[model samples]
Target: MSQTPGDPRHALPIRLNVDDSDSPADVVDALFLGRFANGEQPYSHSTSIERVKPGATLLPPAAEVVRAARDSDRSATLAQGEGWTLLVSRWSRGADVTVTAVSDELAEKVLREAVDGAQDEPEPQPENVTMGFWYVSPRRGPHRTTRQIAAGTWAEVRPNYTAPVAEAMDRLMKTTPDDIAGRLLLLHGPPGTGKTSALRTLARSWRDWCQVDCVLDPERLFNDVGYLMDIAIGEDEGTAKGRWRLLLLEDCDELIRGEARHTAGQALSRLLNLTDGLLGQGRNVLVGVTTNEDLERLHPAVVRPGRCLARIEVGRLTHRESVEWLGTEEGVSREGATLAELFALRRGSGPASVPAQHDGADAGLYL
Candidate 1:
């Protein structure tokens, strides 16, 4: 299926797998029945289906259509006529629609019905700021595969960093698009030191002008051209101020290290290429990488001066800071605590809450 230029939603053609014995219409009906078992009213008409997609309407390219289907916050409406079916699915990223029939005439008629039925439907409004993790879809190839995961906000993620590191972050957060020359932000720290938390704050602060999307699979992000292209070019926003996109890669220790040249091969090269090289040239995109590796061990090209807008080393909070964060009257004598430990401390007193530290270590996953 193709979308007209003036249309706010982009239509993606979804190929349905029909059994040899079952007709395509029957396969469509089966999808609705499955949803019904799950208490979803997927069907809306006498014999039609209408469901909600995630996210607002932002028509993405063909490569991003399927991702949009699974990620957008829009609705999916199915209207069928004899020998034809027209399906429209909206996603946080965009929309994915399917139109199928034995003949073009029937398909056209179904499409018109689907459109007319949706005329009075209110346009879905997505959250002003969204933070989510995306993974390559197993059903679709990397190019069109995207699944979104909800992420925390700055208020929810209370990151406690060293004064210097916190100051650097504050400066970066205050920097606007015109204040920077480079497009890369590298946050490196030990495990459980709130690197991901800092990234979340950045996303929340930049939400007005930036769209933050996490790449769940950093190993294949740059290695796969189709995936990289879909993320870099296919997902740019259509809004006047929401043109910028931040691609977050978490715990990518191997991709930026000195040995990455040989170990990660093209992955390292492609990452640098997107940082400041010609590949990143016209796109208003920024790359943020969180690694546990030291800067000294990273490729010189990756950490070279002027290559990054902000290079922050986020470490555990100081003794005093941790004491304040933990809300103790007197300062603790221990070295410090990671944000994870602090959060666990806050939760430990609650019902069914687990201890913050287990065996002298943070008791939760890092990022």
Candidate 2:
């Protein structure tokens, strides 16, 4: 329960810049941010991260970058940028904000404004309150570089999906506020659209909802650390929750890479049983896994009626959504193109875009 600031035992650091170009987002030691806001204190006893809104924006470092713009009384929507990536929002105060995929241009702008001031358009408000404000995303690992993906990499994909993105987030992040409110909630989304970034906020929301011990993310493990068959066995007798908590797995498809192998087989079995609610104390054990893959790929048993219990699809974004959000982030001189447009036109029908194709993607877990 006691972990020093440098104690890797409590908060292990993943490699920074896990993949080329991508940083912080992939390396963070997935944590349930809900409790962070309640003043539960961070796992790192020595180093205390400033508490800001989940996804607040920082004004560009322009000349006279006042906290509040003179003309606009509304505590100027916050905006922060690194390179081309830029995250814009205002936190609800006393929340920890960690924005990712910021652009260097925005970075320079922030710096310039920090020293000087520039007249530009105001910043954007949240798509909704649940979306989070004042991001606090840092480097994913010790070696990972800082990023602002929510600002840069993620583009809107509303047109791609039949449901509203904000609604999806609400349904995903919002639960009954049960005892296990901090349990895992899986989410799936296409690449370059913002799955990891969304989870960042989800983690924050989870922490905000309940007094959680730790929020564990399996996505980064699957990607960088690979599937540690050990975790498949279920959590140890001791955990932060003291009883049970959430464990999120993003892009679970990656776990199926070696289904034929003995280790993977055991791993798959462990996942199936856990998802089926066969293991762990049901009191507060909630498991969520998101995949671009279809349900067929997932073991029927795992995703079946009672196993997964709840399954939701994160569809592609509409043309308009892409244009509006990305347009704002990209600072498009002309606004007509959409995120769906860019995804459709620029990229091919690759596996990343066609997540539904991976249907039964989590099927193996049930099998």
Candidate 3:
């Protein structure tokens, strides 16, 4: 065992006998705990986890402090300084870097230095929105991935919506952080009405002030408490500390329908808690849901006054608007046409000639 000379209390040597059979995680744990075991040293300790930015590598400032380190394909590098031990574990998309130091200030300082130049920079295209996606993996449990998706401006796609829907969306598109009165944004209507398109535009419009994330397994999210908490408390990297986030759960007709209490069990309650109950108290998180169910079919608790920021029914365009959109009324119906139908018409395939519709249960496929 070799010990660095210092105040005897803080100079405890990290000496562990290793065997070939010892796992990498076991060794890493020993190294971290050996350096700063509780009550062994007179210094206070703190730890923090940082989600590394995409395309950024852990650099010199962090690497230079290392005394004893280890590396592997899935790596965990442990570094020691005067009174601190830092552990950085790299994963596929990001690294979880944690620092334990003598004081909260020192721990924070070390963490900041380690992650300072490691965040992804904002792209030049404002229409390209960065989105986080949450899902459960069979092997890894709950996980999140991020990507930059192109979402055109609301103005460019305004013609896809009916006049009334467009008017409502205009107000939503112009919303700033100060205008937030509720934490739920509900979009409900028939299929092929451009609900998904409107959400993409909303993401682009609110890119500056908000982060948007899609829960790929929304059904599992509400059912699993641990997964739900992970998402609720997970901070978005590359954004300001207090930035708002919109969690989009698409095609959640059953989760918010009138019989959700009976069908979804505690899922509905958990969803409501995330938006307005104790779980939502100090978090700047908003829940955005898209459903094909009509407004009357949704749960009253979900659409209650003061519970939602916006509840817009994104329906088909009116007959007049549909005629104008297609440049002729050739395939336009007297009632109206969905955005999907209009696109089909423009592509020389009228709605009537389109393939047979699937059972109504899977209407979100048109999105």
Q: Best-fitting candidate, measured by lDDT?
A: 3
Candidate 3 per-residue C-alpha lDDT over 301-326 given as tens digits, one digit per residue, 9 for 90 to 100: 99999999999998888889988998
List per-prediction Cα lDDT, in the order shown. Answer: 0.61, 0.37, 0.78
Which lDDT value does model 1 have at 177? Answer: 78
**Candidate number that wins on lDDT, 2 or 3:** 3
Runs off by more than 4 Å, candidate 1: 1-84, 87-95, 100-128, 143-159, 236-242, 329-333, 348-366
All predictions: root-mean-square deviation over Cα?
10.7, 17.7, 6.5
Residue 41, model 2: lDDT of 28
lDDT of 1 by residue, 1-367 (tens): 4545754332433345666765433454445333223222222222212222333222212212221122222454444444444455543433445555555554444444444433222343332345545567653354332232234554444446767877787688777778877778999976667786677667767867777878889898888888888777675323244468788988888899989889997998899888788888888888999988988888898888888988988877787787777787242336676666566566553211222334333332333
Regions more than 4 Å wrong, model 2: 1-165, 177-184, 209-244, 254-263, 276-278, 326-367
Q: Give the CA lDDT, 0 to 100, for residue 208 in model 1.
A: 74
By summed lDDT, the worst window of 10 consecutive residues in model 3 runs over 41-50
Prediction 3 TM-score vs. true: 0.70
